[model samples]
Target: MKLRLWPDALFGRLALILVIGMFGGQLLTSTIWFETHDHRTLEIPSRIFASRLADTLRLMQDAPDDAARRELAAQLGDDHYTLRWIDGPGVAKAPSVAQRTVENLLGDVLARRLHRQAPLHLMDAELIDDSGRHRGIFSLFDSRMPSGDFHVQVQTPGGAWLDVTGQEGQAGRQSEPRALVIEYLLRIYAIRFVAALLFALVAVRIAVQPLRRLAVAAEALGKNVYRPSLELSGPREVRVAAQSFNAMQQQLIRSIEERTRLLASISHDLRSPLTRLRLRTEMLSDAASRERLSADLDEMDAMVHTTLDFVQGVEITEPRHQIDIDSMLGGLCDDLAETGAKVALEGHAGAPVSGYPRNLKRCLQNLLDNAIRHGGSASVRVQDERESVSIIISDEGPGIEGKDMLERVFEPYFRAQPGKTHGSGLGLTIAKSIAMAHGGTLVLRNRPARGLDAVLSLPRG
Candidate 1:
């Protein structure tokens, strides 16, 4: 398996970026601080050693003879350093490369303290452990029990040599390098990492909240174009987006209103000519020709009305409210049964659904009318579910002849039984539109046994 170092979510990615940045910054800062601290640790001890050696040399120069000088050296001696009169130089040859560097550092400090350069020889300068064995100079600051041993010889005014042995004590051993590192990791890195993570999560959450709200509003717009506009409260970008969406909705509403008026005008104009034609047909003397023309006129009028209804169903202007599915279905069935049409309803809708009640009823009424007209009977089965509700209206007639006709029936002016004289062929088209307006679906399928089943499914929310 391959490793996935990057996260998918915006919050996760932001948090990871912040945490890594903080860790890198802390590492860089700690590195610089450790370097500076190490240099100071070495410099402070060197200065102290130099000052003490300078004072000792001054005392030895004032001594009367060898015995007095030896007595004075013993008096100046302490746990940190020991001084003695030597017959020859303490270090026979010159100091090595590492020792030379340290000797020069000490010599410069001693000269400044004494106000003149002193003839000095460095024999050994090294870090040591408790066993008195030498350790590498690089481990001086990091070592747990760090100590220093120094051997030096200085020439007096009389050309005699004085040997000094100095030792660094274990006063600062409690603050070990390992303990310092652990403290730095906890106090600096760990604390900051957690703080960065929380900050990133909260910041990203707040920033993305507006986007989530906008998405929800866009989805709802399809169901109801006149739903309340989004509240403009957030960053500038979010506010701008909300304003644009509201403008778009207003534009859609205006366009739909214009189309409705245009259709209404055309219907009115067509009806006036149709009315005149019907009046002129009434004056015809031949009875057979009059009846045929009257029937044609009636069909044309019905087609005009059905076409208008189809267009109106495409965009329902009514506001949504709670609808009792059971009550509505029962009423439609009762009305049809009263007219001697076979209609039956089975199953109950446990809860009311939110939708345009008139449009929903019209959709159901059209499906029932089609079933009764073609199949001689209609049976509706309501299936209520968690997210949506399904109303299955079945008929006992011979189902659509061809598989293609099942879908083609939903198209405007496309009738399954083309020779039928009653319908304007826009009933199924209008019903499908109403179903879509309520964020639902209307589909027709052939029953396993016989007849066609029209299933209308509407979302609960």
Candidate 2:
């Protein structure tokens, strides 16, 4: 099995890239926020707690005796801060990792304010609710659960330990770790992911629309050279491409027109001289010489006519429309039957094809004629499909003598049976050209049962 981390389409791939990039940015931002927020949460409370402890210690040191110090400590205690005197060390159990961190920060602050060091031990330091239940300090950051408690014992100069407790609260209702985590996921990850996805889709779609239109225009050009020019209504690059394509189409049209005019001139100039030559041959004294000369002139005339017809078929500018292929094939078979040609038609085209009707008919007629002349009989079959349609014409006589001749037979003036001089040898050449003009293909192959098959495949769209 293979894993595909990337998508194939432009829109999908672009959207994936955008979403991943946004998520990475959000993660970095959250990490920075956590660091700064944690420091602020610890700093402000530590400073206030240290200042009050310094004042209490100084006042206790000035008292007359132990009883007086005890009475003074009890009077100075309040709701947010409390103090108690013990005869021995107050904290016995070891502090946790989080408690140790809090202990060191407060210890340093208190020593600086009092201008002296005292032996200090942290008893407890953790997040808590109003009911005084301990909460994990390593849980997700939430503004709701802002209250916390800090307890520590510090040894005074008189050899007695002073137990100190400080409680702090922020302005919000308390919440649990599970609820905080869910809130953080929804706010930070889910919202950003959905926003990035929508943005990427809209931006990528707008960017790729021009490219899609350009591709469709290029395809239409192949089927019809005279297709309407592309509309220049996109970004600068897209407009430039459309302009270039239109210029190329115009150049092609001009070149074809020039070639057609030249062929027309040549046809006129050559026929008059050939007619004069035929008249001169008819004036010959010997019947054998006259017959031979006339036959040669006739062959020359046939060659000229066939050559012009082939070129005209290729350069035809017929407009495209829906063609009933089955009806056309049936009609051709009936006409050939009346002329004593052994032609058979089978199968129907399930749908109409979009193409030049006259050119397609000419292409099919040429294939049928070639098959009947060489194979003595022709069988036509139509295979309709979703994307394309196929017309297969099979003949039943000795097929092409060699495999190489199958392709060579479509070349102009190249005959498969070299000894036979009946054909002008441009039939298959014209048929192939017509197929290409409609963005279709015409292929010839030899049959296993001693015949030839010409398959013409035309695209549905």
Candidate 3:
């Protein structure tokens, strides 16, 4: 089987809209909150501390000679910052183990707090001591810090400015906003998913209310035509549809009632004239003429009666009942045989089916009468399949001709063999109508050996 995928329906679409809107609003609000809170909370404290450390570096750089520079580097070892002095050649020399240990400790603390490792970029101011030729080597990545990296600014010896800033690791650069962003997004999605499901359930329930009403009203209409017309009310568009449907139903009922009344009136007016004609024929003088006129009158009466029966038959709305197929067919065959008509029953049966017993009986009787009238006899069979029951009636008469097999069978007034006036040509029509009323179908097919097969298949209720 091929599967087809279509766009979301009203309920699903509504759910998506609700989830997206809610998630977007929540995400935007979270972003704004984080920006304001993070800047005021952590960044301010780190910047203040950096400024103080820079001030200490400036005092050390103001010392007069290499001796003072070395002493300063030793004194400030781990108290607040590390100090280093530069020679005239600006060469940087290593710091003591104490300074290195303090830096490592600070880096560890930052890593624990921020979930990332970053080096503190506190610069050491450089200056030559009183020995004249370059003092000792002072080490720092840069004295004039640029904004591209995380750095701080501080005053040095001789009123010069030095920039001290942090050195960022790859993980530090990526982790800050990336972790927060993923947190916010996952939260938004969780809320959105839950909201969407709730929205879908509510939307579907509301949307199907009108359909439920329509189904109930339709079922009631089928049971009783005199029931009140359905009222129209719902959403604007749905209301309009409901009104239109109610109007159409009323119109259809009116039209059917009118047609049925006309048929009844015509049958009444027609029978009176037919009765009068029969009386008039009784007064004819010649015996042969009177008999001929009586025969003609009888045919005319039969035609009128058959036509009226067909019209009224069309209006039958019988309630279905459980019927024993085996017994019904068996009884029918027995009746026909008692009447001296050659008929036989065949095939497996004994299936109970739901249908209009009276109407079904009339249909079968018509088919059997047609068979006995045209053919020498008729044979009846019944079989029950998984989905439905099938009844086959076969007649050994000269089977229907080509094209006539399909055409002549169902027409309202058309007859076979031109002028052989026998039936009102309504038997097959009535049978077909009865079958349709029971949600079944009747079909005509030529028997391969010789004859015609009438198959009636009724769906299982």
Candidate 4:
């Protein structure tokens, strides 16, 4: 058989979509975050360092000489200081505290040269002394030209005020911003990946629950098992699916009932003609021919009755009432024994089962009669299965032939043993019908050492 590739329930498809959506959302979010924030990650740190380094260079502009500039540079390049200028045109020296290892050798050497310069000197100068503290200032200017003249203000140590300015060294170099930005983006996406996986699993479970229930109900229905109609709940689509299942079940039951009613009506209508024929056969004059006609009519009558009984079995309308199968079977065995048939009860008894007592009794009676008629002695055994009940009736007689063992007995008017004038072969058929009517089954099998065994199984309430 060819199998369809799509899922058959709303929840299953929902779960698939949820998983796909979660994964897609995670991917999209990470992609956008990487695209937008990649450059910002490295630029933030670089901008902070650049601003502080610019302030330190301005401070060094008013220093008295190279030694004072060196002291200031050492102070600015301390472990706690994040600002350090690179070498440019005039002076050159390694920065004292190198927190970040610069990948470009030229940028590091340039920064060292700029730090050694005695600030950028210019011709315009202003002398300002604030208390006894020495202060220095320089104009903010573009770094492309090192000869630009700028104003300067300063206060010397030992309460002296002085101002001197001049043009200084060459402009500094910049490192590539790509690597740090990429690393930061990768870290962000890794965190989102773990979160997305957990969210996807939860989404899958919630979405698939309805589909699981539908699967269980469908399986039971396929097996001809009785299960309650599903509740119409969950998402709108899932509720619609449940409604469709309910409608389909109703249609199936309706079709079965209609077919059974039609068969029953046919059986009932045929009975009148069958009775007349039986009466008419009795009126024949030739004895042997009359007897043969009577037998044929009897068989026809039995067939009609069996057909009606089977049809009734198809309609399961009766509410299940608890019935003591053990007591019922025991009483039936005693009744048969009293009637001079060899029958007995054999096995441990269990609790009562939920079923139609009349149907149960009828099933036992049919089996016992068949056993006694063909197999001589019959024994009824009752036992309990976990959630159900079972009754086995074995008889001691010549066992059925292996070739005819499986399908012979259940068919109407099919008697395996010949030359025995008895009722039409409707006994096992009736028994099977009664068993089915009560939500159970009847099966016939040959006993290993002796005769035939009839097994009846009933579901528990």
Best by lDDT: 1
Candidate 3 segments whose C-alpha is farther than 4 A from its true place: 1-167, 170-258, 275-300, 347-351
What's the lDDT for residue 318 in model 4?
53
Best prediction by TM-score: 2
lDDT of 3 at 57: 51
Provide TM-scores for the models: 0.65, 0.66, 0.57, 0.57
The local distance difference test score of model 2 is 0.79
Residues 1-461, candidate 3: write the lDDT tens digits: 66534335554555566666766677676645543433322233343344445445545556886567567656754522334443222223463333343344445554564454433433222212222222212111111111112323333444433334332212222223344455655665665667666876687669767866777777655543444667777787778777876887788778877877887788788888878898888988889999999998888777767877886665555666789888888889999999999999988654688877887888899899888887879988888898789999999977788866555678786666546546888888988877876668889888888888889998776
Whole-model lDDT per candidate = 0.81, 0.79, 0.63, 0.59
Candidate 1 local accuracy as lDDT?
A: 0.81
Model 1's C-alpha root-mean-square deviation from the true structure amounts to 8.3
Task: State the lDDT of candidate 4 residue by residue for 106-189, as single tens digits.
Answer: 233325644542323222311112221112111111111112222222222212232322222223423233443456446765
**Which candidate do you rate higher for TM-score, 1 or 2?**
2
Q: What is the lDDT for 351 in model 3?
A: 64
Model 2 is weakest, by summed lDDT over 10 consecutive residues, at: 135-144
Give a tens-digit lDDT track for model 1, residues 1-461: 88779987666777778778877887877755554444444454555677788887777677788777778878888877887778987435665555666688889987887788998888877666555666544454466665667788888656788888897645554446677667767777788878877887788778878887998899888877878889897999999999999999899888878888888898899999999999999999999999999999998898778778887766766888999999999999999999999888899888999899988988999999889887899999999898889999999988887778988988889877778646878889989888887889999999988988999999887
Candidate 3: worst 10 consecutive residues by lDDT?
A: 139-148
